[model samples]
Target: MKSKSNKSICKICGSDFARSGMTRHIKSCLGKHFKAKTKGKAKRLYYLHIYAFYNPDYFLHILISENARLEDLDNFLRDIWVECCGHMSSFMRPGQHQEIGMKNKINEIFEPGLTFSYMYDFGDTTELSIKNIEIFNGAIKSKKKIQLISRNSPPLVACDECNKNMAEIICAQCQWDGTGWLCKKCAKNHECGDEMFLPVVNSPRTGVCGYTGD
Candidate 1:
């Protein structure tokens, strides 16, 4: 399916930016000045590239301290994309039955090129494929356990009916048919009614129950 614009708004600065440029922009942006930094010695950090298993183009790049726990990453994912109601989550190596706990330090198990899976909400779960892309020693900028680097530009999706204007809503009932995307005007008269429609969001979790994105 065709997607929407890849642009994203910086929550801190309210600046508009393309996905590819966000990482560099965020690093030196004035917004960073307000966030608290780690006061002690520098430590090794891991940079991860996380993406939706089914929609690989929808992704995020992030940095975390080596000592940060799996739970830290889980909370980051929840805050940024998938949290709605309190939900259970888990991480495990693909094809393995053993689950990794939130308390486990990232460096204890993660390494370059390693791939893992994350599942949120046992029912109607959102699955993510995570890869340890790079590792390096660096100074952490904020007291927060996770740092955003960049993310995939939102996909540009055209209205399925008008096939001209951008899609602004998706019909929950018709989403699986791939004919659910609609422009705002089309959405009003849709057979599914306004209640069945959800806002088009920059997330793989879009259309899932109660997820509106951060």
Candidate 2:
């Protein structure tokens, strides 16, 4: 797991800075500014805020080009939080059962005040609720279709048995009975045994099937 520090390294300049300040710093960085000027084309971008539907606290803020396909967004989500076992996934408009496909353009389907749903893995689905927060017309530093703006730090879950050390595993079977979390030590001694415990990861899909997160 990555450190929860506010600091991040600037990819353009190889300089260290607080996460909140990096955006501003990058705009003025010599390397990035030069690249933007060289490209000479600014694209329309959309800012999206997405969170796990059932676990709202696990969230991400991202920027994607308006021309980018829905498939790009779907790929980004899978790479960052949910892909495991190559399960099928889909996007659906609110209150509708019809599934939206990858060929759709972002600008065609999303706008401010619009919300969408994403379901990964048909059987043990990990659902996400996405909202179009804002739209921007500007130059992007990265060529990637999706850029991560920010994300909620991985939450700390205490060991259910000791109530001290951070939880390292979750017993899927015990989750329903409300005593699933356990640290490394407690997990070995858990009544359900280690086989029932899944490694806790920084993802909403944690403890679901064979998912261990990327």
On lDDT, the candidate that comes out on top is 1
In candidate 1, what are the lDDT values of residues 147-209, reduced to their tens digit?
Answer: 776666678889988898888888988878988989888888889887887888878888887
Q: Where in model 1 is the C-alpha error above 4 Å?
A: 4-40
For all predicted structures, in order, the TM-scores are 0.82, 0.81
lDDT of 2 at 196: 84
Model 1 RMSD to the real structure?
A: 4.7
Candidate 2: regions farther than 4 A off: 1-39
- List, residue by residue over 7-120, the lDDT tens digit for candidate 2: 445444567665456545644553344345644576777877788999765777677889999999988999899998999999999888789988999999998878899999
lDDT of 2 at 158: 78
Provide the lowest-lDDT 10-residue window in model 2: 1-10
Whole-model lDDT, model 2: 0.77
**Per-residue lDDT value at 187 in model 1:** 85
